[model samples]
Target: MIDDSRTRVLARPFPPRRCQALFALVAIAFLAAPAAAAVHPGQAELVREVARDTGKDPAALDALLDRAQKQQSILDAIGRPAEAKPWSAYRPIFLTEQRIDDGIDFYRAHRALLEQVGRRYGVEPAYIVAILGVETSYGRVTGRYKVLDALVTLAFYYPPRAAFFREQLKTLLELPADHLAGPLDTLTGSYAGAQGWGQFMPSSIRDFGVDADGDGRIDLQGSLPDILSSVANYFARHGWQAGGPVAARAQPDAAARPIEAKDARPQWPLEQLEAWGYAPLQPFNPGEPAGLQTLAGANGPEYWFTFGNFYVITRYNRSPLYAMAVHQLAQAIEAGAGPADPAP
Candidate 1:
């Protein structure tokens, strides 16, 4: 049992980053209650909705709630903000020599599966490899929180975003009861509770999971084929255009006018971006839609003219650094620009 006293203690002296402390509060809420109790009104309605859609029984979902609540402490530990620090803080952890080496081996081991998914979905194998490399160090560490706990805590207790988590909760209860990683294994992850190799949310799993190995069930926790397939499926669903450019080094025309800052969609027209002082490394027709995302670099600033495909990568995680890391890692892995290591 976790020291409930520690729950009152912050993980660090620093203020919480990314609202991570909320995860701790969420954990406590689930832990304080019976996981198998009748669902909250919102959850009860959601369960009915899921049951109606999937043709599953609401009664069948009670076990999932219990399982979710059981993993609360583990979720609290992993969901703290330390792991989700900013790029300056996060970069050192992932871009290590060992990680780079393992990335190579991961590419080799899952070469066929990754390549196949890339071909089918138009997402590059290198990008997929990079994603896995960053997410779990090529599956070296998936997590220590039971996905059930993380989901339930966020689903029922985190009211700021209860509706979203509740939907994911509904998806979880309706999935095969046997889909858990193991009875004893508690899968760990970010405060938002994304799970498995790709760090997919339950809704995403339900919507995008695929059986790359031709298996009857989609399993992201244990199967490389399923994980790769699921990642590709997610990219495709987000409008990843095959053989299309993801991003490019661009030079904005000094004379170019800036586009009005609005709630811009990733699918915003590339031509429109070009009109706003951005020019690509190479010449291309202005018919494409792109966005200008600026990030902090080693020196001052780095800018990217991102196409629709690049936007699709952002769908994995909203952060520009996350997307850039995946993109750069893919390029490095494909070029074999770094040392190799054994696959995990």
Candidate 2:
């Protein structure tokens, strides 16, 4: 759970986006960007937008923007996403033995709560644990940047996703108290400005966050029930299938049709992929909906059949590598945790 009891909340501006930890901070030649030393020219426009959408005082909202700093580190980090790595490299990062073991331990430690939430949401307990495991290392390292600073920097300074981050910033401000991880200024997670154990952005918190503790608020960082249930709700709402296959290794022969790496959304039947020469190592219903993914593995080219549930995992962070990592980690945790235990 996120312990923000000692966190000092500061005022920050509002707008929109979704976030998860998808990058590592890397040194960049252009790290010396100017700080948002004063209110950005766009801050006024943002304030107007927020005020119009949230009914907050314009002067108060503008004051929050004044406090939000533009951090150069965020710029550097966003410029170098870990998704740029091949699957062989990315897999090792999240699928480490230590991470898998840690996921199992987390599930066992919170078995009753995790299982209870799983039953309530029709999501597997292990999947919930896997998401927390991958997103923030079982809540051990959410991030270091103040969310306000990260979003402010990205929204005003970064051009590529400025429009998206600007909207995220506004959504953060407009979020109800119940949807926040903690005090506005104290919120922090990932270079992308996500918050809490699951690394959710403002819009995710608003739309998908769950008030699991019956405390009238959703605190993803400090409340395991909130974090676990929120993650499960996100999957369920996005069409997660209970007890369905997640992913499997596939064997593509020399005569296999060449396929390009693209979006992991399932678009073909198993029959189509079979005709294309991609065969799963594990038998699957030939009529099953599946997506084909090709990745560079240590042993050479690796093929995978990702089901609807796997695609749902990608909705959280849209990388096939990320989804596969979560699926494998969840499987490992399920095996380690043994049979399901009754909720205490």
Candidate 3:
């Protein structure tokens, strides 16, 4: 909740660091309260569209949407995602000693179950655990905003991604009531309206979510099997190759052809990359397809050959930095798991 006093600060300009907070305060004052309480006037079409698509009562859906509160903080968070940071800064956020230790502990505790899910889906257990550790700190913190609020605010008010979020909001409404965490008004998730330990958006839930426990429900919040399995399933569906390499640090020769990856997808064969002057430290199959990623490291530029599995991780979140963080964190956790951890 934003403080009323903070809203009064609009009388003066906020410093650069405080600018986001200032925007949040002003927006919240106008967005969350009496005037902005109802669904945005523009959302009348969305309610009708969702009702038509889902075969639900239009009046019911409209009344349900009335409960949503527009959140300005969500807009603020989206505008400045951490992925915008340089790789040097981004790496430290997820690669800290504490997170690594905790990841090891979390993995060891759920080793058997995670391994089972991994083998079933052909996705690595460490990576699955890493997703949880990175997305929500092993479910310690999911976002506080109502899923309804987050999606609706973005769908109706945030113009840049309004169409996309409107679809997410529609997908959410179309899902059977049982699929939700609870009532639409109460369901909570990330600022993007992604739900569960995996932080899946509504469409991801509809598409890749697994009811691994076979209890007739997909409970990503409370069911470890569901969370871990759904994540692994998403990876598998996105083309994670079983037992395939994810990424490897490379030593680029001084004359290494400056290669820039437009995306994480593998676009070069290992042999071709070597011929072009970027040499991976480890020996990989010469014919293996890979992509080169150069990161601005603390020491200098760091080169890495990201393979198909790495690209699969990137599908979960489009940022290559996010995929790299998950990759390195998974590696660190695997190394620290010690004698207790068995091979996947």
Off by over 4 Å in 1: 1-60, 63-67, 70-93, 177-191, 252-275, 337-344
TM-score of each: 0.72, 0.87, 0.87
- Candidate 3 ranges with C-alpha deviation above 4 Å: 1-38, 339-344
TM-score of 1: 0.72
How far off is model 3, as Cα RMSD? 11.8
lDDT per model vs. reference: 0.68, 0.87, 0.89
TM-score, structure 2 vs. true: 0.87
Sort by lDDT, top down from the best: 3, 2, 1
Q: What does the lDDT read for residue 155 in candidate 2?
A: 91
lDDT of 2 by residue, 178-267 (tens): 788677888888888999999999899988999999999999999988999999999999999899988888888889998775788788
Residue-level lDDT of model 1, residues 65-113, one tens digit each, is 5445534564465456443665565556667777777777788776766
Q: Which scores greater on lDDT, model 1 or model 3?
A: 3
